[model samples]
Target chain A: MLLEINDIHVHYGKIAALKGISLEVDEGEIVTLIGANGAGKTTTLKTISGLRPLSAGRITFDGKDISRLAGHKRVLAGIGQSPEGRGIFPGMSVADNLHMGAYARKGDLSKELAEVYELFPRLAERKGQAGGTMSGGEQQMLAIGRALMAKPKVLLLDEPSMGLAPMLVQQIFSIIEKINERGTTVLLVEQNAQQALQIAHRAYVIETGRIVKSAAAVDLLDDPEVRAAYLGGDLGEPESIAADEPAATADGPAKD
Target chain B: MKTNESTRERTNGSPTVTNGRPSFAALTPRARDLAGRLPAALRAPGLPLAFPFAVLGLVADLFRDWWGRQTGYVRWAIYGLLIVGALLLPSEQVGGFMSPYSDWAQLLFFPIGGYILLAIGLNVVVGQAGLLDLGYVAFFAIGGYTMAVFGTKFGWSFWEILVLGVLLSALSGVILGAPTLRLRGDYLAIVTLGFGEIIRIAARNTDYIGGPNGISGIPHPPTLSEWTVPESEPFTTLGLAGIAPLKYGALDGRPYYYLMLAAIVVTIIFVKRLESSRVGRAWASIREDEDAAELMGVPTFKFKLAAFAIGAAIGGAAGVIYGSQATSIIPRNYEFIISATILAAVVLGGSGNLPGVMLGAFLVAWIPERIRGLQEYRILVFGGVLVLLMIFRPEGLLPSRRRKAELAEGTGGMGSLGAEVGGPTTHAAAEVGK
Candidate 1:
């Protein structure tokens, strides 16, 4: 395992946001956690990113405990995140926003710039524009581009498809897949279970901060209970088919 | 070919599309790149060059004085040449046209110049870093009082007291920032305001610090042996190597003028360099949005404290200069009004704009002195003018383009509703949303 979270608990004042959540991500795998609104999906990501301190248990990445490390130091140690709301530096230029992700690095950012531009060509054309002026989808692209500039070993993406049009949503997922294929492991948190599971190698289903199920992407798509409660389906309906496969599989045709 | 054609089209009149929206490319690519790179490059290297250039300029002036002493006719000719230069130059540059070592100019420029330095230092915290620091004047007062006590009561030299004052002010800044920085906006402002008042009250009440009467007879800075002129009998214009004997007095305006001028130059360079580094960017980020900055891995609390300490240290340096040059310091001299005045200077000049701040300081400090007849009405007129300026030119006299854009965008919907009313309305709405 590249990262291990052993029963961590997190609290926000009197409210417990995460209660004994445990999961693992093996090296070079796309792992995702899918849940509904207020299911503590964001809380889980925040805990891993060190934005919120854990109350109990330990988080170890690459054989070392990082429960005590600050968020920036964790970023420097190769865990980079594009936060849920697309936290681009709104006041800064698109190019300057990208530069900020590489703030921990020393000298020569041309290579990083090139890599980011290759991934998102629209970003190159709008490099001089302020990040605030971008459309929601474009801003999402900028946020992802910024996180990639940090040269992380593992990228943490939170709701990359949120507030995006269906076409842009498809594009973002494909880019996430491309990013994973380029050798960086990914941990994604999403409410869009259908799209997230399509690209993920393995996924965990969480409810109210507790992980209720964990399985391979195909298996989770086939699970009736998961499809019924969390995947927005009735009990007797065929399980939502994984969209990647051809028509007429054992699971039936994919839903539009 | 298409890329080059598009580049040329952009250079022409084709509206540049930014983030799938229209934004006119006001500055060309080369100009934009230069603007980005120049400040970052010059910021670090500029300070080390300042002291050397100042020393060299002083040496050159001394040589010019010696050359003028060669003959009575030569002295008269130099004066005539300076007069003609003043007549030909613009009114603004006429200050430069005068003799570099003029006593009258020194007296007029010194205190206000010191205030300008203090404003820039304060700007680093309140303006660039977006920390509301009404107790900024406390740092200035601490510096002044430190210099007065050390230089006058203890008989310490000016240079030693300067270092002591800076250290003391920095300590005070850290103390103030540690407790109040956790508070945001108005709460922070109120805390700092109370802190400033407390410092002033303490200065007035403390008998060890001369109580309400304050300290006096602070000694002039000790001259370096190499630069010091010998205290000899008056000689004719025709002396050794045809150089006239230099005049010396307790308040010889020439030496103080050069010293203050050097101090201003040093402060400018220091502020410019500081605002360009990684530290500067961090401060800017904090200023724009604190919560966002915090999430981006900035240790916001620590950086805010650093801003306060650094600003206080600079203010302390200015205070030392003010006390030594004036030869007295009093609690009455360091009041809330003084803090307001310094803030007014920063705002009028354009916060985060270095040269603009300096110009603002000069205007605010000297204009009233220039028209002493209106001294009684100074506060009324100054306040009225500031209000008018804020109304007409909200971004200041020389506002940075980025700051202007921010203000424009931040207040895009509330056009001409008056900032005083609109500012609170929008801020309340934002808070409610949060």
Candidate 2:
């Protein structure tokens, strides 16, 4: 396995955000975690990234225990997260943001920069523009491109298609599929189940912080349970979230 | 909770009620007549534009912008000219044009220079790293005490003491930052405030470091002894004829001022470079969003501590200069008010910006002296000006584009996003942005 998250439990004060969730992503595979709001998909990714400490269980990357490591160390260990809502440094220009992504590493960024620009040509054109000024789709591209700059063996993508238009959603998924094809393992937390499953090799259905079902992506796509619950019966007309509903992301609840 | 909510509502609603009621309706005939008798110029359109300070500030800004935009040799030439101008500003003629302020202007340089360094140091902490270090004076205290104790008790040279003081101050900064950095925002502020008080009280009570009387006899920087000017006619003719016999004594304040100027120049260059480096980016990322920064592989804590340490070191350097120049020190000198004033300079000048903070330091240091005649109203007017600045330009007088954008408009793209979702994890994230 490129990454293994074993029965990890996470807490938000008295509330259990994730309850013994276990999942794995093998080399070059795309694994999707599908769930509704407050369902712990984001928490699972965060726990894997070491942003959230696990109450129980452990995560190992390439046979090394990584559960105790700090967030940036995990990035160095080849776990990069394009956090939900595209966490681009708004004050920094596009090139600087990309440079920051490569901050932990050293040596020539030209190769990586060129590769990222090739992946998203739009970004190359706006290299000098600040991150905050970009459109939702472009910012998402920057987020993904930034994560790729880490050259991670396993990429953790949390809601990459969240606020983008339907057309942009398709384009982003295609890029994710392309990224997976490029030999980097991917652990994807997404609300758009149909698209995520289409690109993923394996799918895990989580509900209220526990895995309800796990199977091949094709099997889960055809699975009636996931369709009724998260996919909302129709996979044709793209669904839109409650604007800020996804705000329930795994960042944990606001501390009072 | 219900009562508190109602109280909040009442406070918010009073402004609305007043807004709906016309001021003229509440004004009695006598009050209205008095208002009508006020000067006609006050009621004229574009009144703010015509205001003296506003006009002066506009002109100053224009000149500053022109100077700031010069490139390469031109920029260096301008800076060289300014340095020469500042160096040659004789104490004899200082502020003579403004008769009332003349007597105090010469005394202003030392404090103004000290405050500039402090403001720069604090800027790294509060502006770059976005950590509100209310206890910054602790570092200054550490620097001052080190200079005093080392110079007197140990019989160390001033230069040697300065190095030791700066290192010790940096260590103190790391000590303060390491454990309490997890505390964010107001919680962090309170802890630092307590830390400042603790340092003051500890210094007062500790006999080893010298009790309340504090260490004194801090020596001035060593002078060039037994120097003789060579018979170089060409060297003397370069407008340095008066400066031929070199002397580094601190008695005149000129040598000390030049040292302060050198320190400022080196610090400004070092800070500006650091601001654009990888660590600088990390500081900004941490400032923008700590959680997101961490997730993106930026070691937020390490970078924050680095900024704190650098800031502390700079503050300590300022103290060394201050202590050496004054030739005396007391523990009470490093009080809470000092930290607050330095922070005010950083804020008013513009946080995260070097030039702005320098300007702020100058204003904070120079303005008090200029208004010394109005001592009774100085603090009140000073506080009023700060409040007005906060209300009108919270980003500051000369805001960094990044800071201005963040304060004037809401955060872009991410908006209500805490990044992971639902913004709950955003609790500390919100604090990072500030």
Chain A TM-score by candidate, in order: 0.91, 0.91
- Candidate 2's DockQ is 0.24
- The best candidate in terms of TM-score: 2
Calculate candidate 1's fnat.
0.08
**TM-scores of the candidates in the order shown:** 0.72, 0.82
After best superposition, candidate 1 residue A241: deviation in angstroms?
A: 23
Stretches off by above 4 angstroms in model 2 are A234-256, B1-70, B97-106, B225-251, B405-424, B427-434
Interface DockQ per candidate: 0.15, 0.24
Which lDDT tens digits does candidate 1 get at residues B1-434? 33442343333312233443323342243223223332566634444433332333234334544663588887668757854442222222344433233333453446566777887887888667867677778888888888888877788988888889989999999999998787666678788889999999999999998899988887877764334332343312111121211222364544555555566667767777888888887777666555445445667778889999999998888888777777788899889987778877877777766656766776677665555457589667777667645543455555553454344335211111122222322332222222
> Tens digit of lDDT per residue, candidate 2, span A102-165?
8888899899899899999999998876675567899899999999998999888999989889
In candidate 1, which residue ranges exceed 4 Å CA deviation? A13-15, A35-39, A205-256, B1-107, B178-191, B223-257, B288-302, B366-378, B405-434
